[model samples]
Structure formats: C-alpha cells, structure tokens
Target: MSLLEAVAMLAYYDPDSECTVMREVPFSDSAHILLRFLHSRNFQTFMDGVPQITDFRYTNEAMLGIVFDDNFAPLGMIQNSMGFLEGGTVVRKSFPQSDLLMSIPLLSDLVGSMLGKGPYFIANDAGPSPFELGKGPLYRWANFDEVGTQDDPLFQDAGGTTTYTTTENEVSDIRDVARVIFKGPLNLTEWYFSTRLVADIVAALFPFGRDYGINFLHGDKLESMPKIEFIAEQGVLSGGTFMFLPIPGERELIKGYNHMDVLTACASLPSPGSARLRRAPHWNQLATTIAIPPLLVPAPAETQTSGVADIMETIEDTLMPSLVLIISYDDGNRVSNSQTGFFCTPQGHILTALGGIRNSPMVNVKTIDRGVFKVKRVMGEERAFNLVKLTADVPASQMKPVSYNRSIPVYGTQVYAVTIPGPDEKTVTALQVTGTREIPGIGMVILTTPSIPAYYNNCPVADARGQVLGLAVSESSGGAAVDFIIPSAVILGLFVGATPVSFEDWEAREMLQGLDNTYAEAMRLLWLGRFTAAAPLFERAAKARPQDADPLYYAAACYENTKQAARAQTLYEQALKADPESVKVLFSLGLLHARAGRAKKATALFAEVVDREPRHAQGHAELVKLYAGVRNRDLMQKHLALLRGLDPDLAEDTLYEIESAGRTRR
Candidate 1:
C-alpha cells in the first residue's frame, strides 16, 4: 500500500473523525487514475459498488497519486483548518459524525490542511470500539439516537445499549479523488486553489477590488477549451454567468480570465455559490463599456467683407462720444464774422487779425460746443504790425501744445499759398518763398489777387513747412503777374529788432524789397481811397491779427462800400458786440441799417449815440442824414441844429456842401 493509502485508512477507521487527502498530478494524466488512487487509499473506496482496500503498510507512497484530468494541470494548494493539501484530493468523511464522503477537489486542499494542522482533529474517547469503528454499528447507533430515547429504556440507561432496526441508506462509498492535472510541469506559483481565497486576499489588500466581486472558477469550462464547440451568447460572458480561478501573483496577465472559455467551463459546473463565483462575467464588460472617446470639435467660420464693415461701424459708434475738434478754419461765414481771420498756433495759441480788436480790445472766441469767450489781447498796436498772440486760460492738465519751429532759410523758393478772398470775389493769394533774392534779400515772395483791387496790405505768408517767407504788401497791373511779393530780408532790416539771415550763397540774394514795399504802399493808398477791390487785401491783413477790431471794422466798411449791405450789417453787428463802446462799430452799425432801408431804426440809433456823446459831430451828421431819408423834416433840422451847436463852422459847411453836391450831381 502507498503512504497515501495508509493515511486514508487510518482516517477511515475512526467514524467520529474527518479526513482529507493531498496529491500532485502531472500535465498528461486521466481522471480515472485519481479515482483508482483514492480507491486504494481508503477502506470505503468502491469500484462498481464493491468495497476495495490494500494493506495500509504495503501501499506505495512513491506513486504521488493520479492526476485529476487528462491534462494533469497543476492545482493550487488550499490551506484550511484541516491543514494544507493539494487540490483534487477527496474528503473521506465529514468531521465527528457521518460515514458518507464526497469528492471536492477545490475543498480538498483546505480540508486536508485543516486536518493536518492540530486544530481540526481530536482523539475520540470512545476509541476504536466496534460500535463506532465501522459503518453498520455506527449507523445502528445513530438510528437509535434518532428514535425516542424515553420509549427505549435501554438507550436511557447509562450502561445499557438498545438494538434498533434501521432503514438501508446509500453511503458515499465512492473514493473520488479531487486532484488537478496539467499538460505542463506544475509550477507552484502559477496555481490558484480557489477563486474565493484569491479574491478574499485581493479585497483585503486592496479595498477598491470589492466594487466588482471576485469569481473563482472561470475559463475552466469545456467551451473555453480550444477543442470545444459552443456559441457563447454576447451577454453570457458579461452577466453573472461564469466563475474563474485567479492566477496568483499574475493578476494583470489574467485580468479577463473570467472571459476565457476554459475558466468559464470550470465554474459552470454545479457547486455551492459564492460572491467570487458570481462576479466573473460582469467585471470585464463594465470596464469596456466605460471607456471614453477622443475629444474633437469643429473650427469657427471665417469673417467676410460685410462683417468687417460691421466691425468698423461698431468702432465708430464706440469712439463717437470721444471725438474732439480738429484744427480747421471755415472759409464760409459759418462762425462769427469777428472769428473770420483767427488762426491756431502750434503752441495752441489763437492768433486773430489785429484790426479785429482795435476798437473793443476784445475778441470773441468760439469753442467746439459753440460757446463763446471774450479774449483781451490786441496785436499790431502803434505803427509796426506784429503777430497777434491770444493766450487761452487752458489748464496744464487740459492743454496739448504743439512745438513751433523758428528757423529762416535763404534762397527764397516759392512753395505754397494760403489765401482769403476779397470783395471782387477773387482769391487774395500769398506766396511762400525761401533763400536770397537780389532785391528782397531772403525769405520773400510775390503776392497777387485778381479779385482784390490794385492795392496791398502788408501781410506775411507762411509756407506749407510753416515758415514765414514774405509780406504781401502790393500789386501792379504792369508787373509779371499783376502782383508782387516783398522779400523778408529787406523787411527784416527795416523792422526794429529782427533775426540775422544765413543763405546758401550770397550770389543768390534777391533785392525786390523796395519795389514790393512801393507797390504795398500803393495798395494801401487805394484801400484808404475806399476801393471796394481792396477788401481782399484788407482781409489778408485782418487774418494776420484777427483779434483787432480795426481789420474787421474796415473789412465790414469795404463790404458795405461794395454794396454787400446784408453781409455788412451782419459783420458790423458782430463788431459792435465785440466792442460795444467803439465809435467806429457804432457808426458802422448805423450806416449798415441806413443802407438796408431801415431809416427809422438807423435814425433812432444815431440819435441815441448823439445823446450819449453830445459833442459827437459824426453822430449828429448821421442822425441828420437818417432823419432826412425818413422825411422827418423836423427831426432832421433838430439834428442839424445839434451838430451846429457842437461844431458851428463844420455844421454850416456841411449844409452848404450837401446842397452844392446835390445840385452838381443833378
């Protein structure tokens, strides 16, 4: 008998004790070999319902045992209270009671391990007595216990025994070996005795594994084997339909082992259920279903031309509220006539025509909001004409001044013109020149106008580069262009204090100053002669000193002289508002009204002036003229009398001259 057979016999003799068997199998073996091994080892082993056993001492312990299957797959060792034993070994009987037995390869190792360990077995106090040693006596004793003990007085008595009849029962006489077989060497590390044990260890080590329970016997089914033919339904592997043996120490390599056909086959066999067995099919399917797709989005559409236009409009709308004034001048009388000749300086100063402020000594400045401010600076006082400078009270925080250039170059080359029109509806143009001339010396050019009368007002013209070249003082019909520009070099010498000149070469110096000044004086004489055509020349002079009332006053007179009564009236009114106390403006206002055929209003205004200044001879004279036109003979005589009282000689001559001139014209 083998050593294994001896161990089995010793376990079988004691009916009150449990037992286990352990053995290893090769990869190439049959299941019948395992049966024969168990049969030889245990006294209850039966082949074809016949009990068979070999002498315990003679059994060959060298024959390890038969493999559980043809493949002789290696089996995991299960450690239980009975001690550790190899898988596929049978349990001969249950502990402490029954004589029946069954084959459970998965449980054999655990049971064997428990039995081998001291905790699973105790020596029976009843010893190997006949009553408990073999099957028939043990069964009769159990049947007697099952019957009522009180009715059988023999069972109640401590030392007495009862004979009880029992029905014949089938005992598990089959010595089924629960063993593993494999086609290869049994590697100790690769075996998993039970999926339940593996899952319990994994869950204890890593708590997150509990989310999907463990399966113990998957991929061991017939369908999973390569030779088997079975159609697995799609969800069968995904639901709780399989079990698996976990590959020890190779969890990653066997992650989806439950989906393997052989593992499923092994688990599908009828057996007691456990969480490990129930979880095999669903874990892999859950993982696959939860995978995330790649992220990709479409690009935005391109902008069109119309969209660009819309964007520009939006920008304009946004900035419209912040748009400030641009430095520009109105050629038309859109602004006040008093504002006519005003020019802005690079330093943010406003330079007005000198004549604009002569009588009032104040100039009205219009802001971007159309609001007005009275400026109190006069230019061109005395005889020499100077640039009119208007300083605004702008705060440092609000002022944005421009830089000014103050360099004079020689060899006066003509560049550009900045012009204003005169009474004849023609442009009074100025020339900007640089460098030396024979007559003008340097920085001088010619000035001319077809609309202005054959006269000139000394005025400076600046080039596009913002340099002053020459004073446009005169024009002549016989000259090359019926006009002439004076050189700045000669004029500079004439002025009290002037900057020195430096030219590229002295030979290029031109001297046309004497001729230019002469023509300028001639134009001045014509302007004093009340030539309407000289209005443009006066306007040019006015632009140079726009703040002076003189130029604007005279410009208005010239307009009136040229029969522009409506324009004259508006201009005179503007002048009067600028200089309310100016006798010239007051006189112009009266004259403007008279010219407009408002004789009564004119007469009343003149009479008021005479009343304010009792000795005002011009005012009395104007009153007389105004009264006479309205056919108010009495009021006319009264004004005449008043003028006579103020200036007796002029009053008598005025009456005589008026009568004489009236007769001669007729």
Candidate 2:
C-alpha cells in the first residue's frame, strides 16, 4: 500500500471575487443572466482556478459544466462553454452539441444566426431540424447525433442528465424581460453541494444559506469549519471555496499506505496509525501507562539541565527566603507551636493557614532572620484557600513581603516547600504538585503533591521564581503522605471588594455604553456581509474604545473589502500594535500576505498563529495548503498531524476533496 504524502487541491473559488457586470434581474430573467455571466473569465477562474482556461488539462470547454438550483435541488446546466470578458461583458458563446437541443428549435440560439455554423459546437450555431426528411437536411442533435440524413450513422449520448440550456447571444431586449428582483452585495452564511451532475459537474447552485445569525466575533476554530459561506451581490454569484484534506491512503486512490509516514512517527501512539491501521487513543484521549516507563519532561536541547533534583534545587534557592514562620497564641499566651506565614500585602499584611490561626485572638510572626513581630488584627479569612489574612504591627520597612504570581502553574512546574527547621536555618526541597483534587463538602482546592513532614503545613509553597503561593495544609490523617497547598490568588481574593461608583461617573459610563452599542451593531453588519456599511461603524467603535484591537482589526478588514487598500493597511498595523498576541489579527494579516503571493510573510504569520495557539485548526489548515503549494511534503504532513490532533472530522473531509477532484495527481 502506498499513501500520498502531499497536498491535493481541486478547485479553490474565491467567494469575494466579482463576476457579474450586470445585476438586478427578475426571477424570469435571472437564470438567463446567470448563465450569461457563467461564460466570464472570473467564473472560469472559480470553476478552474485560472481565468481564460482556453483548454482544460483534463477536458475542453464542452466538458467544463455547471448546474444551478434555487437554494434546494438541481435546476439546470450550461455545459462545455467559454466566455469572452470584453467591453464590460462576457460574450464568448457556449454551444452545447447535446441531444436535448434538437427537440426545441427556438429555445436554442437564434436559428438565423446558425446560418453557416459548424457541427462540433453545442449547437449554438444550429438547433432542431428546420427541414424535414425529403425536403432538406435532417439536422437534429438530440438522443441521436449528427446533422445528416438517413445515411448518417447515429451516436448515443446520455439524455437523462441535461436540463436547461442557453446561448450567450447578446439579447438587447433582456432588460425589458427582467427587473432587479434582489439587489445585493449581501452575505449569506449557508452550506450546500450540488446533488446531481451532468458530467461530474455541480448541478446545483446556492442550495442553502444560513440567514446572518452570526456566531463568531471571536476567532473560534471549531465553529468556522464545515459550513458553507455565500457572499453574493446582485448579479455576480459567489460562494466560498471548499477544499477536502485527504490523509495518506484513506481513499481508493492508486496509492495508499501502512502507517502515515509523518516525520513524527510517535503521533501514531495517540491517533490511529494512518498507514499502520493500528488502534490507539485519539490525541485528545488521555493515556494511562502505569507499569510502563515514565516519560521524562522535555527541556530545551541547548540547555544542559539534566535531573529533576538539580532543576528543582535551582527553583528552591529562589523561593525559600520569602516564606516566614508563624506561632499562634490564645489570649496573649503561647497556644500553637511554630506555624507558617508569608507577606500578603505591601502594608504589612501576613497570610497564614486558617488551621494555624485556630481562631486565636493573637499570633506571633517571625522571619527566617529570627526577627519577631506582633499581629495587629485578623483582617479576613477563606475556607477554599485555607488561609487567614492578618495585619502585622510592624511597618512595611521591616518586612520582605512576597507577591502573588497570577499565572497558574501548569501541571509539572517544580514547586518547593519553604520551611525553617530552626532559627536562622531556612530550607527548601523539591516537591511536585502532581495534580489536584476537590476537597468534597469543604469546597477547597486541594493540590496533590509529594509528601513532606507535618511541619511543612502552614508553610508557603513557592515556584522556581520564589513567588509565594498560599498556605500548604499538612495532612491531619496519617497514611500515605500527600501535600495540598492553596494558591495565593485564591487566598488574596479573600480581601477583595467591589467599589461603589458615584453618579458623577455617568458621562464615562455613557461613553462606554455607546462604544459597546456601536461595537455590537458594527459586528452585526460585518457578519451580514455589509462591509461598506460596517466599516464606518467599526471605526466609530474603535475611536470609542481605543485600547481594543477588535474594532480596529474589523474596520481594517471592512476597508479592505471596500477596496480602500491604504486605509486598511494603516488600521491593520495599528491593530497589530494594539494587541500583538491576537491570532485572529495575525491570521488576517497572513491572509493578506497569502493573497499577495508573499509566501514567506504568509508562512511566517501562519506559523506564529499556530505557535501561539496549538489548536488553531484554521492556522494549521492554512499551513497545510502553503506547504502543499511549496511542495514540502514533510511540512505538510507535520501540519496534517496537528490538524488531525485538533479535529479529525475536518481531516476526513479534506481527504475526500483530495480524492474527489479531477486533475488530481498523487
């Protein structure tokens, strides 16, 4: 079995392109106008990627076909044609030399025009027999072929599939036959595929349209895929370009394989092996390998860091100094022995375990320097973080208070218990917060860590940078030792309160409300495919909320669609500066690069988007196309795996496209 390890594209139609020179035709005349425009270079580009396809690599103009329906089923087709985009109109006529044309004489192109036309065309030059046998020539190209008398041999072509047919004959009186039924530059979010075909061609047009109930103002990867997008204007018909990504050997192509031959062979352990056909958990599926060898944490190859202990010791050296020891007293008498505490505020606030406070009226706080201090008052406490907030009597000058780290530690960051074993003898040891658990009934977050002595409780847990976390609670029950610590953020939340705003703030509030309303309305227009209308609204919203990048970004996109290139570039740059981390902005800018044929810049932008967000399926999907364009099979496979990791359904559809399109080469 051999699997294709490359990108395969069928047709990539740009839904935003302009094709119709005329618009606003009545239902009676719409189909005729639509057919007339189908002979355009722009439509041909949509049908076959490049404009003016004089001769298709796989088939000629007669083979290039299309069928249209009214947002539902197959209607009719104009097959084997070409268009001449001249003088603001497409005139090169389509003469389908099929069997159906022979039945209707006047229904075909003008009979007088066929004057001395040839035999090979779709009968644009000729139609049903004007003269019967024994009178003149019997020339009817229908279920039977040829423009000959009884002596001519008959040829049979399938008669069932052909529907409505017409010629690109310039009919000056067409406008009198038509009225603009629907004036558009409207966008419809819908999906449909032609259900029937004449010769493997789309026999349906705009079958379904999702009325603009927009779901994504955010760049949601999952919601964007698997839907059909229609961007229509009065006469020019445009639909989104659809591509199917086929993995190696999934289809009945001449070549298929064993396991997908990607550079990262290990991916097979997660997803089903592409070529190997082996069963495995999906990448999203968590794995449990109890008895097997543990996977070591991967570090930068350039860094010489070896063992967990070395790395852990490095982390401990930073966190130990910030932790302090606390001893509680009941009614000014020594009650509890040494406990743990850490600086929680700039103005001498100390945070300790609620259990350590034991509801004691007073407490003694000591630092690693053996310096002692008095507790002024108990400020606040929380059960979830297992913490009590206390104000110390000493000034901030004498305290080396620790601050909280807002970013949560991911599963495997090396954490340490900072404990003072004796006066002036502070210590730190490598510990792991292996996972977490919910302390049922108590509503507390209990972190699961490696075991340490009971004394470690009431002690602050710190990461490699010495940022103080919340109090670590020692296990009251004796058995297998497990350590749990509260996060400092949760502990700090105990002291937060909402501030009341006065009526004087109304102007500011009203301005904010205006920005909010403008942004919302602008988004509605943007989603509705009314870019020209939405552009100014978005600018107003952007001005109202200068710090926000979305309004500027969207305004720039709207401007670009409206052909205001200079203004679009300026806004895109401003949006990029405002929020450098926005992948949506990056992806949009990357699309600009891709459209300009700037391969390097486009790849860089797309690469950055995926780098910032691994599961950005659209980013990865675009990369797959880029790699395929450059014929970089390795890179293509790499992103193909990432896309599969993100979404398998999309991958399957992509594979179907690779196998289904004509002119496909493995």
Candidate 3:
C-alpha cells in the first residue's frame, strides 16, 4: 500500500466503532494519486434495526491527506472532502499542487491535530471497561493465533473477553504523515472550530468566513418516529456583558458565552408536519441607546477703565529725560541717518536700534537738557535683535532710567508710543494693543494698532501706568504700527556689566548682513506717507539687490504717490524688465498704462495676470472696469462671472460700475 493510503486507514479506524477501508486508484492528472474510502453501511443498518438503540445515526466523514517525496517534502495533497461526478462514478478531488497552500502553517497545524494512532495488537481483560454501555457484545472481525498473547483492551467486547492478531504495519507508518478528518456531514465552506481553536483560526479568516457555527445532528429518520429535537451548547472563557433575545413563535431560551468576540446564529423554524430544515435570514432585531446634554452659553466681560492724562504726565516726568536723538555721519561730515534712543543706566548707557549706526564712523547722542555728545565706548550689541548699547559723557542729571513693566500686555490694552525728534521735543501717540508674538532669538514682542509715524522706530511704548513695555523694533503690518517690539525684559539684559569695547572695534564687526532689513525700513516709510524720505531708501535697496524687482517696484510706487509719474513710469519699466513674471509689477504697470490712456496695452497685461493666477480677485476686478469703459458687455459679463466666485464683494462693486456706465451711455 502507498504511504497516504496507510495513513488514511489509520486515521479513519475506531476500536469501539465501525471501521472504514481505503482503496488506492490510478489518476491521470497533476495529482500524485487518488484514493476512495468505502464506509461500511451494514453497521448503520444494524443500529437502525435494533429497537433499543435510540437516536442513533451514521456520521459521514471526509478526509484530506498530504503526500511527500523521497526527501519528506510535500509533493501534492489528496482529499475526498469534496467529490465530483466524472463519467458514471463520483471521483474524489485533490487540492491542486500549489506553493501558496503548502506554505501556510495553519493548514499544516490543522492536519496534524486530527492524526490518530493505534497499537500493534489488542488485549482482553476480565474486568468491565469504563466505556461499556452494557447494550450487548460489541465485535470486530479479526483472525487471531490460538497461542498468541493480547497486549491491549482497545477491541475488547463489553464482557471484556476478546482477542485479535496484530495488523499494525499499516498504522505505524503514519508517524510522519499529516491528515484531518471531518467526522459529521461535510460542508464545502463551513468547518466547525472548537472554542479553543476559534481565537486563532477564525480570526485569520474573518468577514469572508463569517458564517461559521457548530453543527448539531439529532437522530436518524424512521417511518413512525416522533419529531427530532436537539440542543447545541457553546461556552466562552471570559466575562463581559451579553444579551439574549427570544425567537419568533417559540419558547424563549437564550444564553450568552464569555470571551465570544464573534457570534453567528443560524436557526430553523418549521410548521407542523414538516420534515426538512429550511434556511432563514440573519438576526438583526437588536437595539441600543445613548444620551447627551445641552450646551451652555458664556456672558460678555466688562471693560476696564484707566486715567490717560495721568499716564501721560507720569511718562513725561520720568522717561522724557532719558529719550535722546541718535545721529550718524559719514567720513565727509554729512548726516547719514537719524533715529531715537533712551538711557538704560545712570552711567550714560544709551540703547537704540543698530540699523542707523551700522556703517557710520561718527555716532553722536543729543540729550534733552544736555548738548550733543560723541559716543565714547560700545557697551554691548545683539545684531539679530537690532539693538546696540553705547556710553557717552552726558550730565548726571539727564541719565534718568525709565521704569519697565515686566508683566505682558494683552489685546485691546491702551498704550502710548513716545518719540524724540530733536532735543527737548517729543511726540507721544496713543495706540491700542492689538496682539503679541514670541519670536525665536528675539523672545516675546508686543504688537499694537498703528497711529505712530515711520520715525517712531526705536521709540519706547508704555502702558497706561507709564511703565515701558518694549522698544518699537520694526515696520507696521496689518493693524499694528510696529511689526514687533523687543520687550523690556530683553532690554534689561544689556545692563549686566560686560567689558566695554572701542567705537572702532564695534564698527569692525560685521555690518548690515542682509538687504531685507533695508527693504523693510523703506516699506515702513512708504506706508507712513513719507514719500520723499522713503524713495531714497528704496533706491538704495534697489542698487544693493539689482536682481530683486520688489525694491524697484516700491520705489516706483513712492514716486507715483508724489505725482512724479514720469519717474515712476521709468522705474516701473525697469522693474518689469528685471522680473517679467512678477504679478505685483504686472498689475501696477497695467494700472499706469490705463491711467495714461493706453487701453489696449493695459487690457492685455490684466489678461495675462488672470491667466497666470486664475483666482486673483483684483485682476478680475480691474478687467471688469476696463471692459465696461469700452462698452464690451459680453466680455465684461464673462469676466464678472469668474470674479463673483473669487471675491463676491469686488464683483458687486464691478456690477455697480457696469450699471453706471450703462446709465451714462443712455
């Protein structure tokens, strides 16, 4: 016999029950071979004939066995689990030779679990066996030697006085074989798994194999038998909440299992006199509930009031003496730039921005009640924060240190910014605190609404109580007069005693590392309506960065603000030549052309802007007005429709222009 046939025979035999015979057959396919199992039908017929045997039915089985090569490696598999009809006989099917199926460890583990072994010989004992039901003499037909000895009671009769010869060669060869047997009526898809195996096996095949359940078999059919009734019990291994509902038109009997991750139910309901089982739809009559509460609303806060005049007088008396005008000069004695500063200590340490004094060789300080004095030494400097501390020979009475408010200011807090234009002359502007930001290397800086001018750079911004918050550091952005402020906490660190360096040594350090600071300073002047003062700075920045069109464009804007159109036009064209793809320059140049009556050139430039950036709302707005001027209604409406989606407010204004133009024509 072949190795697979021997293993199948050993796995199918039961010492206390009926035995099955395995027969080898020839196959002409990819399978190594085929086998047929013939179960004995006489035992089932005998049990049915006996009146004492109750609820007894034969269990149909299917098995699959794997065959290996000479090297003990898997060559192919054979299975009688799923049989098909070929010609006139039901031919058993074998799983196709595949590396994917053989490589699965679960398949090998399952096959190993069902393999059973038997002893070489049977033994008879005088005492009754534990498995005895006392029904009658249970028998196995086997030939035995008269003088031979029995070693086991596996095939002993109910009275325990039976013996048989050995036929263990067929069973002992299955030690290296792997096989599995389904003991009941076989299903093509559903394989019943014990609760212990379900955790590992069912979890691997979930969703696709979601219809798994334990099969319950009742009894055999008889001519005059009562209706067959059965109960299947399943258990779990852990504790949790569970619910059980009643079945329709039946006694309500339900229970739940612990550690049951997945529960599948399949029930059969039948009318009286029905003999066959019918499938039903899946169970879905379960319900659940949850609760939520209402949301609460918050009340508005009361605004705090403070004395503005009292704050102003306190600042003038305490901080005005320390405020000084910083002036720098070139080698020819000509003034380069000027800004504001304040004395941080009684030793004449004046703190100010580094921008105006970076490249100047002759830096001087003008105090409130003292004459102009030349700086003697550089106390400290932090270029990233745009700060420089200097000492000069000022009168002792003029060195009043300003009080600092270390507490942070919040939005909507009223504050004042003080600027010293010249000796004993000060400009104080009241501003509302807008917001604040914490920047790297600069720490926390304050932001406030704009009322101060461009020259307010380096001025001190004080709270209502006349305490200095921070020094105004940079240009205005959005609603804020200053983009950022170096807080009082950061400014106080410069007074921590350090070795003083000569003015030449301080100037020898790196000066004006980048052009961005220069451009930002120019933008501040431009935004403050100081066209003349801002134009020269923009021009200086443009000369430094020839490849950048922003400086040139803003310089042109400054000229345009002053009504110097000819100069503005020359600079605009130069900026266009520098970066032809700049959207800002393109739109500005288009506006200039439109004002100069070059309608065709202006319309073409605006069209290019819309094509480059489809969502530019202002580009469409300008196009709407230009088309309406020429009475091009169809083109005007087309661009208007595109504009409405981008900016509805701008589109409404364009629609007003279109209607106004129509009224003028009538």
Candidate 4:
C-alpha cells in the first residue's frame, strides 16, 4: 500500500494515538541517505520534529448536554445534529448546551491564556476534530466504512438464536470518547495555526517593527506545521493560516480548514513550498538570515561618518533664521476710518494705516523684539485706506533689506500678510492676495477677494501664485473692486525721485482727500451732537468700532432724548464709567433723572458734578431744578438766589419766570 494508504488505515483504526506519520520529499537529493537512516533505526524512528497531530471527538452524552442546554427538544437536537453533519462539525451547534460548555468558567480562563480574549467557539460546537467520523468513498477506501452502516451483514441478527441491544447510555458514552479522541490532534493544529497566523498578522500590520527587526521563536524547527503562509512582495504584506481535512481522493469532502488565503494575499507573503522560498535572515538580530538586496549591506563606519557630516552642513547652510512682516489697522471712529496699513516695507520702513496715526503728533513703530522707534520724515500719505509711507535708513551694519524685484507688479503679484492682531495679543499668522481693482468713490485699492476674518482689514490683494499684490482698501463695505497697490514701478520711482503713475490720477486723489475731510467734519459734528440730534451718526460710528466706548455712550443719550428713559439710563451709566470727567455726559445724566421725577437721584448726581467741577453752572442750574421738583422751597430759593449773586445781570423777572415755571410743572 502507498504511504498515504497506510497512514489512513492507522488513522481509521486507532485515531486516538497521540501521533501519526506521513512521507515527505526532501529538497536536496538525499532520499537514499534519509532512507538508510530510517532503516538503521529499525523502521521505527521517532517523529520528533514532525508537526503535532489533532484529535476531535465528542461523546453522545456531551452532544446531548449541548443540545438540552440550548432548550432544544430531542427532535431539535436530531435536526441540529443532521445540520452539523451536512455543514461540517466546525459549524456551531444551534442548541444552548454548547454555549454553556463554552461558558464553563474555568474553561474560558484556560482557553483565554491560549487564544487571547477572543471567543473560543465560532458559533456553538467546539472546534472541528482532526479525526472525523465519516462513511463515504474516502472512509470506505480507508477500510472503516461499514462501522455503522444499516446494510452491514455483520451487525444484522434476524435469527432468534441471539439478541443484541444498544442502550442509550452506552451509545452516549461511546460517542463521547470518540469525540474526545478526535479532538486531540485538532487542538494541536489550532494552536500551531493560531500562533503562526498571529505572528504574520502582527508583522504585516507593523512593517516598522519588521524594519527595525523582531524576534519570533528561538527553536530550530517548529513541531507543528501551521496551515498558514506569509508572503511579502513589492513592499506589500499579507498572511493567514488554517487547517484542512479532506475526504481521501475525492478533494470535495473537505472540512475543518480555516482559510488564511485572504490574509496571505493581502500581506503579499509567500505560499508554502513555492520555488521563491529561501532561507530568510533572522529578524531583530545580527548574524540572522534576512531578506534584502544582495548589494545593500550595512554602511561602513567611514561612510556613516561622512553622511553625518553632510547632514550637519545642510542644517547650517539652509536653516538660517529670517524675519517676517505683519500688516494690520488701528481703531477708527467712522466706517471710512482708516485702520489698516502695511507694517513692514521692502526697504525696512514700517508703513502705517494713515487713519490710525492721523491725530497723533508722533507715530510709533514696534518691532518683534518689542523695540519702539518714533517714525520721522513721513514721505507720503494715502487717504483712501489711510496708508502712510515712510523710509528708514537700514544701515549696511544692520541686516540688509530684502531685494525689491521691480518686474513683479503689485497689481497681479501674490503677497502674504503677517500681523500681530492685538495690543497685548500673541503672534498671529494669516495670508491674503491683493486684488487687481482699485476702489470706486474712495481712493483706496479694493480686492475681489472675500473678507477674511483673520485679516484686521479688508482682503489684501494677491497674485494667483500668492505673491504680494497690495494692501486692500475700500469703504469697508460694498466698495468698488478697484485696488490700490504700491506698484513695483511706483516703489522704484520713490527711490529714484520720480513721480508715480498713481500721482497722475489727480481725480482719485482729490476725491479721496475730499472724502477724508468730509469724514473728519462729519465725525466732529456727530461727536458734538452725540447726546442730541446726531444719534444716527453715532449708530453708524458705533457699528464701525463696536468696542469704542464714546459712540455707545452717545447712543445711550440719543435713546434718552428719544424718550427711551430706561435705555438712556443704562447708557448714561456706561458712559459715566467710560469717561468720568465728561461734563456733557454728567449734565445730560443729571437732567435725565430730573425730567423723570427722580428728584433725589438727580440731586445726588448734580451734587457729584458740582464736586467734580465747582464752577459748573449747568450743575448748579440742574440742582435748582431738582429742588423745585421736590417742592423744597427754601433749597430752590437759595440756589436761585445764589445764581443771581454769581451773575448780577441775572434778571429778577427771569428768576421769577424760572420759579413760576418750576411751580407750574410740579
């Protein structure tokens, strides 16, 4: 008989044996040597290095237990048993008995140590056994097909000479022993497959570990042959392994194989027995077998030293530090208030938004190092977005100014905006592109870009490639798209004392200057009448500077005059806190309460004003009014009489009129 046939016979008759044998072909031409060695061992050589065998068997009692525990009736158990046979015993039992056996407290802890925290049973049945019971062509050929066949004449006893009976208990006990023996080899196979599969998976998922190196096993040869393969090719990785037990010769009656082919394919690991297999270097250790290109050896000491020197040189040359410029605006009192400006210049001059520095007698330029320099000799000012131009003599001893490229026009070039946003705020980073259009109605340049929140001003224009186009300008709302740029040509003209094309645009200049003047005048008037008729102007101004306290204070006064007493009171308090010395606000607040019949409160407020400004005629007049409201005749006459003493021309008739008016109102 062939070696396969012998092995099959042995497995069929005494599958409970702890070991089995199979013939293997060696890679080298040493079959004679191996055979001679086998013969020397009396043809009973120990299979010490052979893979472990697996057993898979269960008693009828165990099976019944699994079924009954699942609340399955006897009929259900029969159906489940049939399904297990058809689907292969690897399928989980549909009954709850299998679940209970798996849940056995001690069993889980034992299995967990071996298989990690993963579930032991796939569904319900214990894993497939290596020695499976079957009656088919394979089993028949293996010489054990007639064991339970109904047609077997050896078991039939129709003659009444003897009677045989198979008790249920006996059947259950026999089945249980058979199942236990069958599972023995299977358990070993599962361990081998699981270990190799886990190692391969870890290796593939963690290529860095492989690159750094890793150690798996210390043994020379594995005792069990894992049914898995690891393949690595073209920098890709995958691996998996499983057991396969097939019916002899048929190839289709296969069972108990966990397919690792998908993992193998994904990991790009080699298949077993492939011609590509070779002695791979041991990972994670020197002098170990490793798979690598033939010529790629570890670098020599001298070469490594040279590489280090080259890296150092590169860092020294290319990592030099440089400075960046930030642009932003200052606070303003109107929508057209110029708060935006460029903070740095190509010539190292720090330009400012004209509006921000407008009223200040001196302009201060601050550096990244917190150095402040009072700027002098302001060259030119643009009233559009309130841009101011100046020049600083950057000495050769200091850092050389960045070279200006005249070929790049501000109209289409891309530029970056670097800014420090707040007075005490941290460094801010942002970028903007200069638009090509100049602003309409206003002389400032405008950008087609959307208003970026990071920019303190409107979007600065930039070229498509993100070079500096120019500082953007507009009415801070829907102004024209016309943008103004510190044109490369114009910048050059400044150094050469030549007039810029922009200067030729007299119409835009006069228009912007006129707008600036108009804005200043409007703001002045609005401030003067802030507590009276200029409420709308204050509202518009407040919208421009939400944080400015002046407009909001005046807005509150507007509310009061408009008969919004409560709103006016709140605003008065806010304004008083903001500007305690504001005589106008103090007078307004005192009169507000006096008119509202809050006599005591008004009196106290007027007294505060008098304390602050002893000669405040309005405070004195307001106090008189409060007293008249409370019908304090003596207090009213005394204050009125004092007013007449202070100004002798004060008409007796006027005092009489005031007194009569106060009396009439009360």
Top TM-score prediction, candidate number: 2
Tens digits of lDDT, candidate 3, 551-652: 788888888877888898888888988888777678888888888889899999999989987887878988988998898989988899999998776786
- Score every model by TM-score: 0.23, 0.32, 0.31, 0.23
Each candidate's lDDT (Cα)? Answer: 0.35, 0.45, 0.51, 0.36
Per-residue lDDT over 1-666 for candidate 1, one digit per residue giving the tens place of the 0 to 100 score: 133334433332332332223232222233444443333323333233222111111111111221111111122122110111121112222231122221454343343222221111111122244344222111101211122222332212233342211111101110111111111122111343446656565653443432332212232342433331222221122212122533232112222121122232222212122223234333344335544221111111131134323433443333222112212222352332342332333444444333333323123555433444444333212122323445444333333332222334322222222333335522223222322222200223343322223333333344444444444433333332333444444343332222222211111221211112322332343423434655565556555544545555665666776678776677677666655666656766776787677877777678777766677787888777666555688987988998888877566556644553443344
**Worst lDDT 10-window in candidate 1:** 167-176
lDDT of model 4, residue 412: 18
lDDT of 2 by residue, 1-666 (tens): 000000000111211222121122223344444443332333333344222221111111111111111110112121111111111111222233223553455533332122111122221211123232112211211110111123322222234242221111111111110101011111111111223222122211111110111111123343443332211110111111111332222212111111111110112211111222122222222234322121222222233234544545655566545557788665558665666677767766766765555545456777756778766666664433345666656655557667666545645455667776666443665555555553311224435434545777667777666776555665432133345766665566454432333222422443354424566556545544567887898888878777767788888888878778778878888899988987778988887777778888899999999999888887888788778778899998999998999877565445434433311242
TM-score of 4: 0.23
Model 3, which residues run further than 4 Å from truth?
A: 1-310, 422-426, 476-482, 494-499, 510-666
The 10-residue segment with the lowest total lDDT in model 3: 80-89
The stretch of ten residues in a row with the least summed lDDT in candidate 4 is: 136-145
Candidate 3's TM-score reads: 0.31
